[model samples]
Target: MSTEYKGPLSVETRKIAKDELREDDNSRAQALRQMRDWIEKNPKIISCRTDDSFLLRFLRFKKFSVPMAQEAMERYILLRQTVKIAFHNLDHTLPKMAHLIDNGYLFAVPGRDKLGRRWIIGRPGVFDPYKFINEDMCRVHGIVYETLMEDEENQVRGFVHYADGAGVSLPYLTLFTPKEAVRIVKNGERTLPMRHKEVHVINVPSSLKYVLDWGMTLISDKIKKRVKIYTTAEEAANNLDVSMLPKEYGGTIPMSEMIESFKKELVASRQQLMDNDNMEVRLELFSVQAKEGAVSALKSGNQSCNPYKTDVLTGSFRKLEVD
Candidate 1:
């Protein structure tokens, strides 16, 4: 369930979306007040600023369940602390990130899909492991964060992703391991607020399928059900609106134009990304220490997670379900 509002939503649409998420301006304001008060009263368990917007983002993601949202917020803080490569020191000025943006390696295309979900496309081939370290995963998070911010105020239904692994060369394949793939996918699925409508993977060579399948094992069955693999771009195009895709994928828009447009978005959002990177999530605020090895793992850029230990919310109100 997503709305196609590109800008300030109509009052009716906003109300519906908020109700669907079990929040309204007044309800959200009250919840934020209560959460902030709780945080101040019990500063040890969690540390959060009174950033209403930040709190509300998570609240919306959790359907305004104060307890659930609080837990999610805390988990997000720990995730950031634990996954340094994808969360630490992100800035738009990074040369590698800039190159990725310019080369169409990672980008969200302008406009929505036929169903109104946003379209985010990534080309792993555009990444040069020699120049771009695996730690650049943090930069990918930064880009995704900016994309979320872009549509935060609007009523968004969900997201649809297109991942092209056709460019996976033998050397590139060697550097890209299943472990790192699991790390990236886990961070995204567990932490991000967006509902992924589906993921269509195009140009999947036999060599890359094993890594892709292994990574899928790490994600929830719900997400796994939404993933579709096509041996060629043409077959994938049949399942999506070609008019909304770029020419490279048999769409109307040219690849050069898409890249240039995406570059502008990156430039426009650069400062915001830099600010978010430095924003504090004080995991040590709790009397107990941060995760035992999180600090060291983060420092050495060796982020990993026990896929089975992830938090799974259970209830009738859970908006996104596996089936």
Candidate 2:
């Protein structure tokens, strides 16, 4: 909202980040491909880009429709508030306004000495962000990100953390991918045990129908099998089957049953994907929200709402300028 954040995703910052990343020889082609596709598909984004003051207008739009956008952005600033703390994606330093995604690196510091729990820290090349990427170490990585809000007393340190399972990192190319493609090619799929059964459907069957269909809509038939893309529940109720539904099918063909079966398939597929996925690969920028919306809603009213409560959320420290 302030002028300082006029456009967190501006060209200058992106240019700078890209150049730095190149120094490490990382391939940004994947991200560029996805960004193009996303912009091309979302007319709103295209129109926003045409304006010289796109950043300001975009923030306002988000404030109106989603107050959280501002919060997320602010949190990002705090996340990198100081050089004392920083985020890392692999060995490459995180870039400004970088969308969090699966495979996106996270850096933090867990308190040391007595406060240190049973887990390990500072193992060289062991996804151990605490040892490096800290306020004191960020400079060594060629990153001068914000300084610790106040590191005069180095008591503030990192905690366990990682990108949201939904985090995404835009390869330098700024490519955009449809949600479905993201779950597939970029994130990959997981197959079920072929035995897990008994699913229950409670939401709008029509909506579920739509999401599952994305697999077939964007995917050509040739490689669909490898991706496990399909219509309706095969052995289950077959919601994808309009041909077999009776004249009274819409009102009669046990639509509820189909939803249940389809749910089973989806749950298992994602579980398979989850098993193979690196916690980072499962998250993307806005992916925390992007990934948790549905699951949260389901558990919101239930007793299992705290998704990351027990999961190891690694924490890291950065230098800041807090008053």
Candidate 3:
């Protein structure tokens, strides 16, 4: 089959898609058409981009299963409507958001890794938990994730996270309640279309080891197995290429330059981020009977529990599995 529709895919990535995702020109075109038709028929989805690029993210993530992709699209829309803190007001020009970007709290590195996965480095330790709440951090993460999703390469190859935990103190750890942590994990695994490959945590203090152990309980088993903890940056460098990393970790490029470039990218994509707010779930569009059915479906499908309700503090942390 002619694979011209697979635009700009490297030979390795093209092979990965063909072998692993069961993708080809014929299947890709068919899946895109099916998804667009499904979106047009669904009343709850008020607006969405039905373009090939936008629809393909869900298609590839679900391995070309139209039904699964449809369900994932619904969950993605519902997440935006319900999670106002993270989804709403995604303007990069906002003072708080700009401040976060300027400080380089979280951003994707410019290039892909050896396996073609994108690298996202987060320096949460640099931010003040007292000044910015956990929700603020979530908003920043949401923006970065949304921005990264625009790239076809990232969607195809997946992502790796390097979490610099050098400066995280007890206060920073306290910012995340058990329920909040659970919600974050659920959203990443269920709502988002991105594939998470690995998470490398470096520079963790001995005092904070227990906190890391507790966090391990909340993630899904697949992600739990992917998590690798390293005592120093040198150890992590052995796994991740230093050339793609900033000079702070012995890379060639200076960290300041990388931060500046990332900030510029966010500013350039500000309008696109703002446009996401237009696509939402409009329950009012449905009839009374339809509305009730829709509400029931949303409640049943939602993986996140009530934010206000705290998880019971049994001696052990709650284990939330990924689907």
Candidate 4:
């Protein structure tokens, strides 16, 4: 297996990929070739990375399903094109981004959990919303997720997000309008090709929890089921492994060291993030398709669910099913 593939796949993870993800050398090669051919044939995809490692991220996320991989790739391209705020100027060396990193706005822990899934700790309260908008938060989140996805182990093992809402303020909650909130949730579930195993939010105040409850209504049931909330750090630690977390969270690792290590990772990935700015889609095609779809929906008298509408908050929030 080592001779056949040169990428970073450990023996244990390779077995899991084979047994669960249905990834074999032949299947991997075939999927890569098909994805590359699709990219070459698609005129709208102005530029993209077709390397085996890059392509494998999408293939593994879709469990080697070529069609699903194609769809995910398309959504990914469209996301980059439409979400300009998140994808623009993705440079880690930038002062605002650096500040966020130094303060550990969002970062992956040094080690994996017992289940082999990586834990990404997020502290949204660390950044002042006035200085850095929600878009900035999304941009930093994108950089961290993108960098982590490069690892084959993370692709197969998946990720668990642990958010500490201790210092979150009402102003922070105000940063996300209904549209922005819905878009962010939709992007994480559909557009981004990553295995989101679970989300654990601890130390959430009443105000933060209120907003989180509304935000939860926007995600798919699969994701909603995976979301868990706790009122205190001790309660959260009872469910999670303490040794893998920082001292603040009843873990051995220091938060300072974790932040420093993640900063180095961001620095290492700076070039890749800069190059990613070239990935784009021809929006005119999507614009025309959207208009046609609207006309068709009107003709058929079908009212589509628009979660972004202000009125969506007044009643039961509709659940978006995962594909």
lDDT of each: 0.64, 0.25, 0.76, 0.77
Top TM-score prediction, candidate number:
4
Q: Give lDDT: candidate 4, residue 118.
A: 86
For 214-323, candidate 3 gives per-residue lDDT tens digits of 66765678898999988899998887778878888868887778888877778777788888888877866645543222322124445343322243422123332212
Error of 2 at 278 (Å): 31
Task: Rank candidates, TM-score, best first.
Answer: 4, 3, 1, 2
* Model 4 local distance difference test score: 0.77
lDDT of 1 by residue, 211-322 (tens): 4665666678898999998988999888878876789898988877887786677677666555655544556654343443222223343435332212221121133332
As for TM-score, the candidate ahead, 3 or 4, is 4
| Prediction RMSDs, each to the true structure | 9.4, 24.1, 6.3, 5.8
- Model 4 bad stretches (over 4 Å): 1-5, 288-323
* TM-score of candidate 4 relative to the true fold: 0.87
Per-model TM-score, in order, reads: 0.77, 0.18, 0.84, 0.87
Q: What is the lDDT of residue 62 in candidate 1?
A: 71
Ten residues in sequence with the least summed lDDT for candidate 1:
308-317
Best by lDDT: 4
Mind giving the per-residue lDDT tens digits that candidate 2 earns over 102-157?
11222222222232211111111222232222332332222211111111111111
